[model samples]
Target: MFSIVVISNATMVPDEAAIIQQLFEDGLEVFHLRKPEADEQAVRLLIEAIPAVYHNRIAMHGFFHLMEEYKIHRWHFREEHRQETTKEEMMRLKNKGYTLSTSVHDLPTVQRLTSLFSYVFFSPVFDSISKHHYKGVAADDFYLEAEQKPVPVYALGGVDARNIRSAMAMNFDGAALLGTIWKEPANAVENFKLCKQNVQTY
Candidate 1:
């Protein structure tokens, strides 16, 4: 099954929370709460808006405490965040029942995460307007790296309704969207449906 991950940004906060909830209700499989600057209160507020049934389906980036509080099972951590926590620490986290995921910019990093994570995110397969200086990795490069991965690799960055089919054709487990959904709250539900339809067609 293909998954749709909704990536959050700081600029769009509680205002966008209800739209996010709508996406989840509309069949968005995963939601990645990535507001690096958002405080604990902001996170709590957003979670509260989302129904309890979907809590476990949501993934938060680097908020272990919140995960425990919300009973969230999926968690994502960037390489830099992984560096702060040791492998043994990660193992302990896994023992406590967190489905760990991490980001990779290259093949070597992908290789390193094989044993540690259940999924890896290979980003920037296309230029992303939401992020500055994020010159994406070529599609061919991503395919080569994904071929060697032991776990599922999600294609992130610059994914939208237009090019999602291409990403799916490459055998990505799924694609993540940030700007495409958050930039236009009113269209989020329909946009997500269109993206999912394209994925199904491919």
Candidate 2:
């Protein structure tokens, strides 16, 4: 299956929960909750606003304790956080049925983390839409085939409807959308739909 992962905006948006629920209803496979600035209570409220049925589809970037509370099994660790985690601890979490994921900037790191994470985000497949002055590698520069990687690799950063096909051509297992979806909150679902359509053709 072509995996379509939508990441939340760094800050809250109007009717965010409602928009999220709509995405889930529209067949969004996974949603990464990445509110780095929100406190536990704030995050809790947002999670509370979302239906419990969709909680399992959420990948919590922080406030992991809520996972147990909400019966969520997906967890995301940022690059630094993943580095600080001991192998034993990661294995412990895996043993308990956690679906782990993380981010990486290069292919070497992705190769090194093969077994530790269920999947990973390789960023800047194109220039970022949200962050300025961040450049992405040319698609031709990527040579690894999907079968070459130990774990599934998702292209992240600057992925949108126009270039999703390019990511798939580069042999990425999937793509993660951030700026493309949140750049205009009103178009989030439509943007996702377009990207999904592009990926489907691949």
Candidate 3:
């Protein structure tokens, strides 16, 4: 299946709990909770707001320890975070049956490392939608690397309905949207629908 993973806004979404629940109910595959600024308590509160049944579909980018108590089965570590985490520790986490995803900006890392992950986010497939001056890889460059894709690589930067087809055309396994999902509507749920539609139609 062409997967769709929705990432939380860097800060917080208005009525985020409601929006996330609606998206899950509406058939979102993965909801990546990525509040870089929030502490463990705040993260707990956010997770607590969602229905218990949907918790397993949620993945987090922070507070790894919370995964055990919260029973969160999926989590992602940025490349830098992964660097800080010892390989043995990461393996231990994997052995415990947690699905680990990570970020990779270089082609070689993907070739060498994707075997270790459930999936990986290959970013800036188009351009940066949120960060200032964050240059994205050219479409040709992306395609060149993507042609050798060994695992599920979710296009992460500047992904939206209009360009999701580009990701699919490049043979990406899925698209992980952030700016489009958070900035498009009164609630981000509409964009989630659009994203899922694009995944089907693109």
Candidate 4:
């Protein structure tokens, strides 16, 4: 089954907590808190704003402090963040009970990451506003690469209610969205519902 994962970009102008709550209410399985530029204080405020009940359902990306404080065991780490880190370091993080996820833009990177993390996000399968000028990989190409991957692969970038069915038809384990959800926070619930419906039908 495909799932909806929201990528909360801290750089967006409007605060999306209310929409996030609605998504939570509507049954979003995982919320990836991915505000890379936000300081520790800002991230804490965001984390605290979320209701306690949703804490276990949501996962913080790159916020180790939140993990320690809230007992969140899932993390999404970027390639650059793990560049100098060794396998021992990754094992240490895993030993702490964190289910680590990472992003891979190419096959070589995907090969290197399969043994290190539980899942991988192979992105830009479609044009993305979050990463301007990033030419996306063709859906067929992505599928071909992902079919060989040892870990489950998620299709990220430019995913929304409109194209979610197509994403599922391509056999992605799941899909992740950033601007599509954050851009219209007030409509988040409906958007997520629509995407979920499409995913089911596809």
Candidate 2's displacement at residue 39, Å, is 1.2
Task: Rank the candidate models, highest TM-score first.
Answer: 2, 3, 1, 4
- Alpha carbon lDDT of residue 125, candidate 4? 81
Candidate 2 C-alpha lDDT tens digits along 31-142 = 9999998888889999999999999999999999889998899989999999899999999999999999999888778778858688899888899999999888755657
**Model 4, 36-147: lDDT tens per residue?**
6888887777778778788776666666766878767787778787776778988988887778888878766776664658777888888885677876675543354454
What are the candidates' C-alpha RMSDs? 2.0, 1.2, 1.8, 2.1
lDDT of 2: 0.89
Q: 134 in model 4: Cα distance from truth in Å?
A: 2.8
lDDT of 3 by residue, 1-202 (tens): 7899888887866688888889899998889999998777878999999988998999989887888787899979899998788878888888989889999887777777745688999877777777768777845544745546677788888888788877887778888988887775474778778878877875
Scored by lDDT, model 4 comes in at: 0.76
Please list the residue runs of candidate 2 whose C-alpha ends up more than 4 Å from where it truly belongs after superposition: none
| Per-model TM-score on C-alpha atoms | 0.90, 0.96, 0.92, 0.89
Q: What range of 10 consecutive residues in model 3 has the weakest lDDT sum? A: 138-147
Give the worst 10-residue stretch by lDDT in candidate 4.
138-147
Against the true structure, candidate 1 reaches a TM-score of 0.90
In model 1, which regions exceed 4 Å deviation? Answer: 139-142, 145-147
C-alpha-based local distance difference test score of model 3: 0.82
Go through the candidates in order and give each one's C-alpha lDDT.
0.78, 0.89, 0.82, 0.76
Deviation (Å) of 23 in candidate 2: 0.6
